[model samples]
Target: MISIAAFYIVVSVLAYVTYAIDKQAAIKQRRRVSEKSLHLLGLLGGWPGGLFAQQRLRHKTQKTTFQAIFWLTVAVNVACLLSLTLYPYGG
Candidate 1:
């Protein structure tokens, strides 16, 4: 459980940094991070950080398609987390 919490903390921090970098790139008209990579990070239990980044950096917040997929990844991540918590022994 401690390891899981630590994993989430690390991944979420990385996700937040990634979003910040992407936002800066967008502002500078530089190459952007792939949407797939962002979504992958969210699906890997970084959605909390992703949500923070979306609100703080104002990145990828208005695109309907991206928003839809982002929410889906959040849902999947939450469901997996719930399952792990409820069935810690893989019942």
Candidate 2:
């Protein structure tokens, strides 16, 4: 359980940094992080960080399509987490 929480912390921090970099790139008119990449991160249990970035940085909030997909990924990730918590192996 502790390991799972640590994993999420590390991944979430990485996702947050990635989002911040992408936001900076956007400001500088540089190459942007692909939407697919962001969604992948979210699906991998980084949705909390991605959401934080979205709200704190005000990034990627306007696109309805992206928001829809992002929320879907969040839902999937949460479902998986719940499954892991509820039915832990070797219980």
**How much lDDT does each candidate structure score?**
0.95, 0.91
Show how many residue pairs clash in every candidate, following the order shown: 0, 0
Query: Which candidate leads in lDDT?
Result: 1
Model 2 stretches astray by more than 4 angstroms: none
Worst 10 residues of 1 by lDDT: 1-10
TM-score of each: 0.94, 0.91
| lDDT per residue (tens digit) for residues 1-91 in model 1 | 5588899989999999999999999999999999999999999988889999999989999999999999999999999999999999999
When superposed on Cα atoms, how far off is each prediction in RMSD?
Answer: 1.3, 1.9
- Stretches of model 1 off by over 4 angstroms after superposition: none
Query: Lowest lDDT 10-mer window, candidate 2?
Result: 1-10
